[model samples]
Every structure is written in C-alpha cells, then in structure tokens.
Target: MEIKIKNLTKIYKNIKVLDNVSLEIHNGVFGLLGENGAGKTTLMEIISTLLPFDDGEIEVAGLNVKKEPLKVCEILGYLPQKFDFFPKVTLEESFDYLCKLKGMNNSESRKQEINLRLQEVGLLSEQKKYIQELSGGMKQRFGIAQALIGNPKIILIDEPTVGLDPHERISFRNLITRISRDKIILLSTHIVQDIASTCKNLMVLQKGKVNYFGSTIDLINKVRGKVWLYNILDDEIPHVDLFVSLQDKGSSIEIRYIADNPLQGSISTEPTLEDAYIYINRKELTV
Candidate 1:
C-alpha cells in the first residue's frame, strides 16, 4: 500500500505552511523529521484529512483524499500530536466512544475489537483504568489503540513521544516497531532517536521544504567525515559549524561535533542520524 502525494501545498493567512510538499509513502514505518514549525504537523493533518490543502493531490491507497474524504477516513487512523481523551472516561469507555464514531454499531463486535486492540497495545489488563490515571506512555499506547479501532490501512502519528521519559520513550518506540507491518505508519517527530531506531525511510523537512528524503542509513552517511570526537580537558576543539552532541565525562566534557576540518587532537568519529540532521540544519544541506 502507498500514499501518493504530488505538489501538495498549504497556506495560512497568505503564508505557505507547506510549500509544494510531495511524498510517496509505502507500507511499514516511515518518518517525518523536522524541528518545530517545519510544516510537519500540517503535512500530517493534510494526509489524515483533518485539514485542507491549497494545491496538489494526495491519494491514500489509490483513493483521492479530496474526492473521497469519507472513504479515506475509513481506512486512515490518526494519532495527533496533542491527542487527549475525556479525563473522566475509562479506557473501555473511550474505546466504546471511538468505536461508535467509526460506525461500529454491533455491541459484540465493538467489544471484541476493543479487546483485541487493547491486547495488541498491551493495555488489556488496564482497560478499566480511567483516562486520567494513565501515565504519558500509557496514554500514547491507548491513543494507538484507539487509532486501530477501524483496522486502518494508514496510521499517521504526530510526535508520539514528546513528553515521555527515557524508558517510556524506548518502550513506545518498540511498540511502534512491533506493529509497523503490512500498513503505512507515518511517524512525525523531531527526536532523531525515534527515526534512527524505528524508521527505515524518512524525510527531513526544513522550513516548509524537503531537505532530505531517503533511507535512514543514507541520511547518517551525509555527515560522514564531518563528525569528530574531541576531549575538552586535553585540547580545545575547533569552532565547528555544527555541534551534534556533547556528553559529560565528569573530568572532561567529550563533544561530538561536525565541521569541515577536524582539530589537531580530535579524532574522526562515525556519523549518527542526529549528526546528519544537525549538519543539514547548520549548512542548509539540500537533497
């Protein structure tokens, strides 16, 4: 299955939020990577039929999103970045409401489907828990569970792990990886770890434009020979164009940075997804 987008554009108050964005997303987990206000959320909203675009065509599984919005919604599941449920509602109650919204009129079918989705997301035992009772990670899992109610062919997830702790984020990433088969799961996030760990293919957006769109490994390779590891205690690192990441070693602060030339004491290091992303942003690297 594929979601085909061509020359997709969205404008808000005469400003182009998405400037002719185009993507051909296939089954499995695909990543939408960019910083805040990079138009990532706008693209997700357009694909999920939650917002309108000014120009271009989008076909979700060969169905035109504009021409057949309702049909597309039937096969599309959306977990928005700011997803929330009624705080007073129980998990079961939330599922019941979602099922009804999706037109699952049969009570027995809704019950069975809700149980299956809950079990798939590893929340079956907590179905009786109130919405307000779930932790951040649990809330995201429940969001996915609700998105799965209609057996959607395409699932658009926006910033799923924004406020989660380290452990919770990793757990949620594993869950995304586990269920990302036989369908298109488009993940939008600024966390490079999420893309490095979960996405096979990703598109990097920069200021409402496509900067890079290809395999994750290829993206990492973009910063090869530019990444360096320097020890601050021993010798000062050069003024680099991009500061990829830094770590504290108590006595010495080790910095992994990207630059055209390495310092005298610094050694060349392997590139990571984050390094590549920083390099792109620092230099405006285009595809």
Candidate 2:
C-alpha cells in the first residue's frame, strides 16, 4: 500500500497549520518527528480523512481521502493522541462493538481476533475491566486494540507512548514494531529516542515545512565531525553557545559541542538522530 500527499494545505482562520506539505509513504514504520504545533498532527488528520484540508490532494491505497472518505476509513486505522471511550464499557465489549462496525460476521472469529489483539498489547488479562477502572497505560493499550479491529492495511499512531512509564513504553514500542511488518505504520512523536530506535526512515518537520526527510543514518551524517565530546566538572563547564549536554555521569559530564577547531582533551563523538534534529531545527530557526 502507498499514500501520496501532494501540496496539502490547511488553515485555521489566519494561522496556517500545514503549508503545501507533500510526501509519499510506503509499507514500513515511518516516523514523523516534530515539536508541538509543528503541523504533524494536522497532516495526519488530513491524510486520515478526519479533518478536511483547504487545498491539495491526498490518496491512500489509490483512493482519494477527500472524495472517498468511506473507502479510506475502511482500510485505515487511526489512534489519535488522545481518545475517549464509554466509561462503563468493558474491554471485550468495546472491541466487539468496533469489530461489528467493521463488518465482521462470524462472532466466534471476531472474538478470537479480539482476544489475540488484546494479548498482543498485553491487555488480555484486563478484558473484563471497565474503561474507567483501568490504569492509563492499560487504557492506551485498549485504544490500540480497538484500532486493530478490522486488520487495517494502514495504521496511523500519534504519540503512542505519551504518558506511559519506561516499562510500558518499551512494551508498546515492541508491539508496534512487531505488527509493522505487514502494514504501513505511520508514527508521529516528539520522543526522539522512539524515532531513533523504532523507525527505519524519518521526516523532520519545522515551522510546517519538511526540514529533513530520509534515512536516520543520513540525517545523523549531516553533522558528522561537528559533534564533539568533552568531560568536565559540573562547575568548570565551558560556556559554549552550540553545546548540548547528552548526559551527566556524576563527576564527569559528557557533552556535545559544535566548534570549527578541535578542543584539547575532547574526543569526537558520532551524531545521533536527536543531535541531527536539534542541529537542523536550530539552523532553520536562526536563519
């Protein structure tokens, strides 16, 4: 399956959320990285046919999102950043209802599919729990289960690991990576680590524009020799405007700084996707 978005634009009153954005995505786990209000969600909403655009075109699986919304919804599964459900519904009931809406005829097969999805998301044990009684992480898992009701060909997930703990985040990411082999999974997130670890390819958005789009390695290579590592005491740290502190290890701090000349006692460190993202955005904003 493929998605083509051409010259897509959206405006709310005087503010332009998406500015002539265009992209082509195929089957894989593609990451959409951007800061809050950088138009990632707006683009996803338009492509998913949830929100209309002011201009341009979007086609998913060769069907236009604007003209064939019902067709798009038939193969599209979307998990918005924040979703609400009936407070009194059990997990199994919720999944069953969504499956029926998706046109599942065999009740036994639907139940089996629901149970499989629940197990995949680590929520099978909580099948009988009410929506209001589950914890936040479990609720997010349940939301994921609903999105998988009809074996959607295209899945769009926005910030899938927003408020979960470290362990829960790992579990969620693992599940997503495992299921991405057979479908097109579009992931939009502010967590740089998630993009680095999960997505094979990524697109960085800045001021509603494509700042960088390609392989993660290529993006990191843009700042190859510019990243420098130095170990310094907390109080004796140098005052450099282009330095980013990657970590502080008690007595010694590992820092990444940008300088034309190599500093004494400082070693060169490889640039990561996070480093490239920061460098690209800072460069654009300053110019």
TM agreement with the true structure for every prediction: 0.94, 0.92
**Which runs of model 1 end up more than 4 angstroms from their true locations?**
234-237, 283-287
Clashes of 1: 0
lDDT of 1 at 225: 90
lDDT of 1 by residue, 21-105 (tens): 8889998999999999999999988988889999999999999999999999999898988678899999999899899999999
Model 2 / residue 64 / CA error / Å: 0.9
User: In candidate 2, what residue range of length 10 has the lowest lDDT sum?
Assistant: 278-287
- By summed lDDT, the worst window of 10 consecutive residues in model 1 runs over 278-287
**For model 2, how does the per-residue alpha-carbon lDDT over 1-287 read when each residue is reduced to its tens digit?**
89988988799887888888888888989999999989999888888888988999899999999889999999988888966589898888888898888898899999899888898888898889888898778877787778787889999999989988998888888878898987999999989988988888888987788888788889888888887888877656665546666567897877677655757888888788877888877742221
Q: Which candidate wins on lDDT?
A: 1
**Which pairs clash (backbone N, Cα, C closer than 3 Å) in model 1?**
none
